[model samples]
Target: MAAGLVELAGVGLEVERPVRTRILHPIWLTIPEGARVSLVGPSGAGKTTLASIVGALQPASEGEYLFRGERVDLLDAKARAGFRADNVGFVFQNAHLIDERSALQNVALGIIDPTVEADEVTGRCLAALQQVGLAEVADRKAALLSGGERQRVAIARALVKGPRLVIADEPTGALDQTNGKAVLELLFSLDATLLLVTHDLAAAELADQVVTIVDGTLA
Candidate 1:
């Protein structure tokens, strides 16, 4: 197999103490650069957990996770944070916008580089919103936008960082069918590598690879 942009080998998650719980079973998978991979499973399955692991949001309990040949699971907390900030952008089920902030400000949150000039950040954020077809609403408060518009704002936020990987967890779950389809199309159009976690089988069809998990193991 080709070396993966993201790789997992025998990775598993377990909780100990009052009660023992195994959230994910040891499994192996390799995703090449620019691959569009979708993960689908039953409600309680470990799909989101796996996405979190690969996105560097959480560390695997065992086995190794590598991103672009670096063993990310072994990185210290600060290093991991830096790695995620620099390379991973995540879109969740909810827009998760700060209601008080304008669409531009919400997207600007993705600009983690403190040294970037304020004007430059605003310029980049405006461009990102425009890319997602939301430039007209750049100054609108997130609270005033419709659900679909808000999600677009979230997408612009994710893309503003110019991440190497985009981790989307049920990104279209909250939208109507039309909005969901639109959101999925926009997400797939991005040039970055994609790892999508969704319950929608149709969404999986858009990916180059579909992985199904059942009871914490690949099914």
Candidate 2:
């Protein structure tokens, strides 16, 4: 596959104690670099679960999963956290911003450097915020911004780390149609190897490929 950015083989997920639902099928798929993918299904399906697995937010239950040639299931918690910070960016339905922090500070959090000067961090943060069309709100607290504006700030924060993979879980759920569309457009524009979980079929269309899950099995 020549280092396809994401690849999955015989991927399956199940819960032991509850035995309530199957979360995944023995599905196999590969997504190359700069490609966009959507995992779409009704509620209770494994869309979000699959996204979590791909982004290394959670480990897989069975089979092989890889990102950038590294076996995700093999990574320890500490290593997984580092891998996610350095290579994966995630946007969720909520921005998950620190209400007390300014947009600039939130963006700066993505760049963790003890030796870097405050001005340097501020400058980089400003640039990233500008890239997401939020320069004007750089000094504003996330609590004060509108939903759309806050989502943009989240995007800026995700990009500040320059991650190769962007994983968004229902990122547009809080928006009106117009705002949702705008938020999604901004997300796709980043051109990272995208793996998204969304219920919006139109949003799924943004991806180069789509995988549908039904009753916890890829359909």
Residues 99-167, model 1: lDDT tens digits: 999999999999998999999999999999999999999999999999999999999999998999999
- Lowest summed lDDT window (length 10), candidate 2: 17-26
The list of candidate 1 runs beyond 4 A from truth reads: 1-3
Q: What is the TM-score of each candidate against the true structure?
A: 0.97, 0.92
Residue 101, model 1: lDDT of 94
lDDT of 2 by residue, 22-76 (tens): 6787778888999888889999888888888888888887899887787887889
lDDT of 1: 0.93
lDDT at 9, model 1: 89
Clashes of each: 0, 0
TM-score of 2: 0.92
Alpha-carbon lDDT, every model: 0.93, 0.85
